[model samples]
Target: MDIQHGSGGTYRTLVDESPLSGLQWAVFVLCFLIMFLDGLDTVLIGFLAPYIGAEWKLAKGALTPVFTAGVVGLMIAGCMAGILADRVGRRPLLLAAVAVFGVANLATAYCASLEALVVLRFVTGLGLGAAMPCAVTLVSEYAPARRRAFVITSMYCGYTLGGAAVGWLTPIVAQQHGWRAMFVVGAVLPLALLPWLFWRLPESIGFLAERRRDRGAVAALLSRIVGRQVELPALPEQQKVEGNPLAIILSPAFRMRTGLLWLANGAGLLMTFTLINWLPSFLTFKHVPAQTASLSGASLQAGGAIGALLIGWLMDRFGSRKVVVGTYLGAAVASLLWIAVLDRSSAALLLMGFVAGVLVMGGQTGFQVLATSVYPVAARATGLSWMQSVGRLGGILGIQLAGMGIASDVDPISLLQALAIPALVAAVAAAFLHVTPRHVPGNAAVLKGG
Candidate 1:
């Protein structure tokens, strides 16, 4: 079958009609590795905090600024890199981003002072922030609509896996070589993957079509995806979105969905990061052993990894909005149950923690999928980066709020229970996303049945 190039939607239709290709699978795997590196580097600092503090002869909490620096960098890149990707291309931006973080992580391993570490971490965050949105956008553009949400979510499962890998690697690496070794490993893996990404990673088809450049290249790429020759008609040129991409997403036509996505994604990240940062300490405060507390925290990550894939499959078969809504609501209930059973049983706490993660973490990743389905190709990277930036802000706010509560000597249980509120907020916001099958005039195909 030949892919007939016409309106923007025709490309989506062509890919949807074709079976998955080897090159498409390669794209998925490469994006997944990028995500994995993103997660490993993002969480590596946290794992190294204790070892770094001990080696530097620093007091407790001296590393807070380092954490803040990284997050601030992530937010900045999330905004800037995404807009640049839309204008330039996803492959170049992604390659540059991975190189930045890889070098930053290597530099982090040899830094002499806390201030230097903070700066390097910030740079690392910049690479990470830019890399993730571009990776997801690339995957979303390539995958068939039938499997769009699933592929994106499953690819993102690499992020959680990367985090989990750090949890295991930190203890072994730190115990033997040093905490710096963690950064070294983080650096080397992504640096090694960079060559592979450059060789294998394909540019977004939508990006090339939209720009009306490299028409031959677009045909070649589409031809490979379909395992047959793709015929080209000059794609009908569309009106250009002028000025900033952020403005386009916020324009009257897209304002409502944008607002709802911000709320849902922000609230989801708020709950996710809060629970991740505080659960172990909170469990310890309740007299759970340190080891057990760590295990409970891990259960959340494990649950999240499982939940993302399951939720994505469900979203594909059913619909994205309803599945996301249900997942967040379930997370709300799971969070409550997790904290409620804390005093009585270890097994129950672990079970509940896992369940809460399945919903909370799962639902958080689901927002990325939802964002992909909401915006058309022209402003997709901007929309995704903005949504993620808001989510990152929510994470910072949640961590800070939790810290304030602990500092003020609030009951740990009360603070833990309050985490459930964000889940409820996310659920309500997702419920209002209203992403039906109705088409906007100029927007390209979103999900066919989202």
Candidate 2:
């Protein structure tokens, strides 16, 4: 019933043993809003690309670097935040992340040229990249074990919802106020939420309780959550977290899991993003009406949202290993189903797209839980961030490769076959990444169970 407070073990148990408090809900809600803003701002540029290109009278491909610039920024900043958050504090980094993207989105409304836009996009990506890993890590640390994965995944689902919302709003906003209006809304929401996050969001309890002896602050935080003082056990003086974040993940204890996670994440994003970026255009080539193609894309997002939630719940219930492996295999089957739906009815395409999302998108959600579980709290933020960084790189590579193949006039069917390989590779990698019940030497409790 009680966590003996000496090290990280007591804190994780304290977190796991306790139920969700009002303060914890506050953290989740705030993180979800950050993620929602992250999603909205990230997708705005993509939705506005056509208008921006038309206004500038540039080739369609000119915006490619603009997109890549953002992804590159995400890769760098995500890793940096991960490395820094444990040392710096998740709350402050999170606020700064929101500020970065929120201000960037506002500035985007007045962007003057492609060059300016590229710079702004990179800044926006920095914010987006920094916010997400911190959000997930904080939420995971806050949530109880029974629902940690589910809460974390649901927190991330805000991004997908935000992306979907932008799609719906783009047409109306672009029609009435022009492309800039989309950026305006994107900026306003995050800016509006900043005050609330600053006022309400508390630092992670695990962060405070494990980092050092701040008994008064930790006790006060417990009071906020459970409405009373939490009894503390006599504990040794805890050491401050040290070492380079990147190096921590590469240590012998974490090296294998890190490698597998990178493989799973990289290949997962490679497969997933290729399908996301290309599916609508590819469907249009099958003579599906453009509207239908758009709707089919919607189906993928909706399916992905559902898949994200479902995978999290399943992983929490059945454990990460089985669910992740199965989800990846399901994705493989779904990819094969995709090949069959070519030139088929819109209904067929939509159905298949939804299935593909449930498996592929869902699998990625499962991987997030798995990857975050391997490390001790010390390297958690860096581990998650690095995994995302690798995923972003893989996404960039995958999308670029798809673009090249399409430019070379490769058949859609062949392109899909190429995409399918990565899903299988993800499955294989996940199958190898298992979580055995293990213990850390000095964390004061069993710290390695998922």
Candidate 3:
């Protein structure tokens, strides 16, 4: 059966065999691979850092600025691409991002000097940064509202798994071949995924509706999932077209929520990158073997997977803000526990690392769910991108701060204790997040419309 909307748009009922069809599953799998490749590329540098430093005869702190440069590039890319995706459509932006990063990875493998590598890595980071928000927006839009968080968290399982894969792959490849082999692996994997993305990935139906003002696409997608054609009302005037894209997000309605999301993202990313980039090194400094340190670092990703799964269910039951605030508080306690207790005992440290992974990584997962729900269909991608971009800046600070803390006389345990401050701040911010009913207007609108 097919139903037509008042706006001369029609939707056909999808077959009812599954909650989501095989096609939807295929799209999810492809998206998972894209994110997996992205995760691998993003962390590839840290895995090769020691080798690069030795080969280039660089001093310990000399390469610090270069790492920061790449992160800055990622921040810029996420912010810029996010707004652009809302304008151009999610699928195209995602494809372009993958292609750009894949080629950049290839170029990076051949860089002969530190300067060249820095430039290439920065460019690579730009592409890497854009892919994430686009992927999140696409997956979130396709998923049923009730299941959105679960599907998103499940997709990111690919990312954590990819990180673990790299942890295992990079050492063996680097040992036999060289550091450059890692880049070669990074460059090739994404290229393989690009073909499937171009062929299989559907442009987000919701995104297409807002862009082309075609209610048909939205209705069709909804019909497919719901298993029966359903009429959709015309968009309210307030939800109608606007010329300026940024104006939509900057409107008074979204200002406070946007700021809160940015804070949440920043704190989350700071904690994430700090651990990814420096945790292994810190372990090495404390007399752990290199292999053991890398393996221990995997606990973070493992914890992230567990956290992502748990928080998604939690958010569905409790609310995004509650889950986020609680996650931050948990992360803070975990960080302190790691420093004061876990670090002294290897077995305890691994357990604590896993727990820290769940809380800190889980917080970001909750943030993504919150960001998608807060924004309207018209500006969702832009909102998500901006939040992610702001978070990337936090990641930059986290990486540099950890480096500086280590270079100075600050003990590793003390630095871990200090890092807990940001997590605590995030918890406080999460408390302030106004939990508006789904599809309701701003706090003012809640009262006025009521």
Candidate 4:
């Protein structure tokens, strides 16, 4: 394998083909699977929530802490995993996360008490949380820059599809069998994929270059992808400057971008969880049947699939910031529509819900793409994980706010209206974001060697 450095700090694979030479699409498929499993794992506990409460003879509210604990665990795991991905490799981190979650999910099947269940759920969440960022980072690095947002969004469609599958499958399976079957199902599905991933999955070429080892492997991989023999530049000997994760993010160069992304992500997640976590119950309050409300929420997810695809194209053409701001503005309008006009016998409510799903859920998916692009390769995973972790905190607060508002005898419409505020704020922050790519100070060295 021949190695050459390009004009910029970018390491060029001396492959005869394009940048996305060997493993791009395969990585995308793997990422999609990871996201799908994440979706399945996340919704499984919710599907079993009612059953667990009944089995334990506990009030409905008693499980709230259990759910919150899982979210907290996920947040922590995501941050840790992101840093690890930077230090180690995305593929290994991703596989480890999946394996950990798979085993923990199986353990959930045998929980004898609420405390046991909560502990198991928290443990499973750590794996669930870590897998997503690792997959996202891998895909982002491999995908063509012009289509990066689209590819990432397309990958997440797996998540919504998995959620829909759970919605349709859980009732039938649990009714015929038992609630424990859901966790068993979740555990088995991911475990089944482990061997395939371990044998076939490729490491990120960028990561290999960063480590200054495996240059030969990177050359070969690039040659295969590009469809011809190629040479790659020699690895730079400039030691990567490692620093405190939080301090790196907060440095003057990244401060504004980081703050803007954190706010946008937090607000977007707050709106999504507030509406998604409570929409079904809110619909039931409006005299819709329980099954109908559940199905309506599923319909919203269906809309999210469409939205993700559309938003990805729009972002590629217009710009990520533009798409994000526009999507949030749309979500705010949709929320107001649901608040003012949603009622029994009004089919328009379904449309409103669907649109809300597209804008809010889809926009949040776009944020992940934006985060990946904004940070340099060395800090990419950490940047994404930090943004998501901060957003998870907002999601927790949103859940609590919705719960308290509904419990206080507040009108459901007013409660949804309150949720729209965050979307509006996200829109404002997104509008202010500039989309020019930042040049890393040391990147020029990598390019010169080529």
Compute each candidate's TM-score over C-alphas.
Answer: 0.91, 0.89, 0.88, 0.90
Give the number of the best model, judged by TM-score. Answer: 1
- The TM-score of candidate 3 is 0.88
Off by over 4 Å in 2: 1-9, 50-60, 231-234, 238-240, 284-290, 435-450
Write candidate 4's Cα lDDT for 1-450 as tens digits: 423233332543232125654477888898899898887787666555555656788753566667666777778898899888888889999999999999998998888888887798789879988998889888877776656778999998877667656666766776678788888899999999999899878987767765665768876767667777656655446555457656777787778778888888989888866665567666766677555565566666667777888888887777777778888888887777765556545466667667777888888887887787777677878898888888888877876776676567677778777767899989988776653224554222211211
Please provide the root mean square deviation of candidate 1 (C-alpha atoms, Å): 2.9
Tens digit per residue, CA lDDT, model 2, 256-374? 77888898898888776666656666665556765565556556666777888988887767777677778887777677666778767779888886787678766787766765666
- Ten contiguous residues minimizing lDDT sum, candidate 2: 441-450
**Which of 2 and 3 is the better model by TM-score?**
2
- Top-lDDT structure, candidate number: 1
Order the numbered candidates by lDDT, best leading.
1, 2, 4, 3
Model 4 is weakest, by summed lDDT over 10 consecutive residues, at 441-450
Question: What's the lDDT of the predicted structure labeled candidate 2?
Answer: 0.75
Residue range 203-267, candidate 3, lDDT tens digits: 88667655544667666666666666756776556534465556766777677777877887898
Model 3 misplacement above 4 A? 1-18, 213-239, 340-346, 435-450
Residue 45, model 4, lDDT: 65
Task: State model 3's lDDT.
Answer: 0.74
Across residues 8-90, which tens digit of lDDT does each residue of candidate 1 receive?
44777778778999989999999999998887788777656656767889754466667667777888999998899989989
